[model samples]
Target: MNIDEKRFTASTEIQKPVPTKRGKSTTTWFALYGFLFISLALFVYVTNVLLGPLRLLLFDPPLFLRINELAIWYSGIPLVIGTALISWDLFRNVTRIRDAKFVRNDPPANRFLTVALTAYNDERSIGGAVKDFRAHPLVKRVIVISNNSRDRTMEIAEQAGAIVFNETRQGYGACVHRALREALKFEDTELTLLCEGDLTFRAADIEKFLAYIPHADVVNGSRIVEQLQERDTQLSLYMHYGNLFAGKVLEMKHLGAVSLTDVGTTYKLCRNVTLRELMPLLDPRINLEFNAYFLDTALSAGVRIIECPVAFYPRVGTSKGGNVNNRIATRLGLRMLWGIFVDWKGFFHD
Candidate 1:
């Protein structure tokens, strides 16, 4: 087989499994969301119950207590365990930030980073996205993967000085996998910046990424900063908290030593060596939650990851990814967690 054929075969050999009949149940989805809502509410209520004494000391005591003593004993215990986990994460990040040993200088202008962006029906924004990255002094070339976009995305990207490629496979995971593969092929590329072909993220943040990339194999962007996010962005209040909650779960699972506040961001910088070593082990069939899967696999391979706070703007076009709606994001988040826990071995094997 030719190189292209071999690449195609490697990507498809571990394709995502076909869904069973039970997977089509709408009732089960409702139950899952219901369960999540109640669990979150109970945790919040119990945490508040634990703070009752301190709360009363700071504010006026309420005539009627809303929390029951039973919940304080039942849920509060689990809350304590959860708090311990978060505390440990906080301690680690605090030490890393405060210690001069962890401080890293930004990459010099000569340290060029190749940019790769994934596009799917983003004709309206791909050109601007490409141009933004190309304008960056540290960016050598901008590469865009138009994942079967029927629009003018390819034309616009090429017009904006990007090397455009078509990815026939139709998943966010597949598109990203293709982008990474193509990025590593460039001999000049030392680091690759991967992002979406939408205007949600800007090129100005590339400097921030370079500063953090020296300390980590992968520097991931975090949109959790309230001040940096534009109004009415794709990250709604529900989606924002949900993403953070999922990030916390992931941190607890594979990366307890590091505190990760955002695992869903597509904009990240990865060393060429890290991608060369990491991509072959990734299963593109993992679908919309590929970022989490990548992080899990990278951590397993001992890749250091750090988050950089980046500004988030409202997209010029509609979102086509899992963040299109809260329901879609929730489903994707569940799939991510399921993959992390139950289907751990499945990602490596078929």
Candidate 2:
């Protein structure tokens, strides 16, 4: 072959597209869009028969009840199919969690776990948060990331004996990424506890995380337990259900065999190995719903995860995250869902 011909062949081979199991093909995308179009058309048709003028325009008055009956059956098919699928998944997850055995981590007298707290204008509770995590027997050091806080959050955290660092990039995901990065810096850090310094999640729940860490690569805390959750907490009823729905959707996406009821909780434990492998793949540009993104990416990376109930207390200061209200929480949930099902890499961050 000629030199130019060989060079062109090499360039074409290098530029060839590679198929990925994680991404959908063009044909699959078109088929999905077609299915959605058909479903939407059916919905519109049924609505026209039930509420629109088409019922009276096309059908006789005596046959209106028959048309309505047909419309009911047509509209109810999708709902029935959807409900049955959800129910079957729920039943399978419940049975799996109920029957599965978990190994608990029993630490020795020496501590090796590092606690990392993400802080953003949390001066009111940073000190207490630092102290609470330090009080845990298994926690060796407390690392706090002050995400460009305009207040005294860094000072208070440092005063409470925490190793504080500043992340100039302003976002919850950025702060958490920095926190995990700093936690891994310690030589003796075998496991990293990631939490917020806002005091919504207490340090006392570390034992629950420890108990579940041996069973999974990452142990996520679930605040859905009504008895464990304190009264007047920031997690309202609407926010709780939204978190539960997002968690279930994620569970179905990656970890269908396991049951998950909370995805927005900031309290979680990660083995150093999994954290090192998973952190590099995460995009810090993801904003308020970063926890869901984090969990989804971890699961996609083949990280085993299990959720354990943890006590959730009301924050010492005002809320800044997506849990401020139902409307904001719903928006964040929708973003999380989109990131999970669609193009996660290009959803929010360029």
Candidate 3:
């Protein structure tokens, strides 16, 4: 071959692109749409099955045929169309769920604080919990309230070198009230996080909880259920069931998110000034053992409750609170249930 012909051949080889069989976009779309169509069909069936009975209940005219036809047959098409559109949007949103990740810093946004932890009989795991808080670069100071422990909880906590406070309060709620009462007296603290002695949080998550507080007076970390690996004993499940019930009630009342259930948590971050003022209003009779729905009761007094689902670890130590005959959790659950009405204010925030 001539040099020109060889050059042209080499150029042709270089310029040729590799063949790639694009997977059938047509088949994928068909499958997705087909699933949606089947879902719509199921939606139509279920809506008719459920609403048909309701028509009889409402239609006191005793008109069986008219109500039966009107209830299901008259509305089937719209129900199917509505379900398909909504399911499509919902499935689209499911794609974005995994986008969430742990964020240690809250950009230029979060108001940082010296996270204050209070402990009583936490000899087993206070160190790890405090270490978890101190691990975050945002943590400036950790004040541990080693209140009247029967064991070496104070020694382990003090050895941890946190500014430890030893108090003689008979109740966890009382200890917290006393601890915060003393802490607020100093006036040096900007923000104080009141974490449960046992609860575990992810790194830098306190910042996420704090980011919403200036906008919301009380910013609470909520579990969005993307990850809730913490399995608790009866105490934990009782708390879980209470929380689920409270969440539904709040939704019904249009009340914004409040951790009405898991209120024993060690992760309460509060404005020192605001908390000090509110502490006096708290029912001193309550303790962490059987009570603390006072946090929910605070909502009735117009305290803003913003939920931020902080990551949770199952209880390293659980108690016999939820045993078969222990009316304790039931009573507390009743308090939470009753408090929804007794201490509830119509939702003031979105």
Candidate 4:
């Protein structure tokens, strides 16, 4: 059954315009008088030439297509354009964005963090990663998962302040399945950042980024190509072009809240509720081909994602992800593309 809903204007009468800041008489007396001055000059010049008695002046300038004649040219055009632009700006109202309020779930407790390290075999650098995660102001817990590591990777992670979870019995997805459940056990976990254990980030900067997310579903840091100017980790030309293409493709899709492939992004912010809701999407044991495999899934379930521009420091340890230089990565990208087409219905369900 269709029900008719009647809606009325919410406010009373709209307000009238008060004199604006720009409405003040400007200091540019020249602009206001330029036209009048030119008109006066032309009038005097014409009068001197036409009046027989006035022609006796020493400067009875002959109007024989003189220098200033054709040169009177379109000089006033700039003044008109400038005035129009100023008037447009002066009349337009500057809008202010209201800040969103993110509700806190639990009473504030001492720094308790549940940093998720999704790793395959980051044994060489897992220790450093855990230390960095623990160094945060309130990180109380570190949940590390050996996605499919064969070495002493889990042990190194455990020693570095993380309670390592083994997923050898299940697929990488299933390991994340188990890891997230454990991370959520702490009642006072104010922030949870799901990160791969291979990359390095400034702990302070990461925290600053997280603080902005209380009102946002996801706060992403976009890569600034400028920062990489002095460094050699320049994004391959192909990757740069590919990323641009991907951005345009996203616009074409017009999925208002849809995220980019990088949205799984090296970093992600989670409100406890959003995290809790997302855990179930982990397919028990498939390596979850893409780390952001759950992004489209999350949006389908209704989550907001936003990108904030930032500079990324080049990788310090063994890099797990980078320019799509290899055939494997290329194939993986193709798969993602194909999935986008086939699952458009699910990805944009909202």
lDDT string, candidate 3, 87-201, tens digits = 5544654433233211122222335566666666777777777777777776776677877877777777767766777777566666766666656655555566666565455
Give me the runs in candidate 2 sitting further than 4 Å from their true place.
Answer: 1-71, 80-111, 255-257
How far residue 99's Cα lies from its native spot in candidate 4, in Å, is 17
Per-model TM values vs. the true structure: 0.73, 0.75, 0.57, 0.58
Q: Please provide, for model 2 over 71-119, each residue's C-alpha lDDT reduced to its tens digit, 9 standing for 90 to 100.
A: 6667666555555554554555564444433333333233368999998
Q: How good is model 3 by TM-score?
A: 0.57
Error of 1 at 257 (Å): 3.2
lDDT string for model 1 (70-177, tens) is: 545566555555555545545554543343133233343346888999999999999999999999987899999998999999999999999999999888888999
Clashing pairs in 1: none
**TM-score: model 2 vs. ground truth:** 0.75
Instruction: Return the clash pairs for model 2, or none.
Output: none
Listed per candidate, the RMSD to the true structure in angstroms reads 13.8, 13.6, 15.8, 19.1
Residue 261 displacement in candidate 2 (angstroms): 0.4
lDDT scores for all predictions? Answer: 0.76, 0.76, 0.54, 0.52
Q: What is the lDDT of candidate 1?
A: 0.76
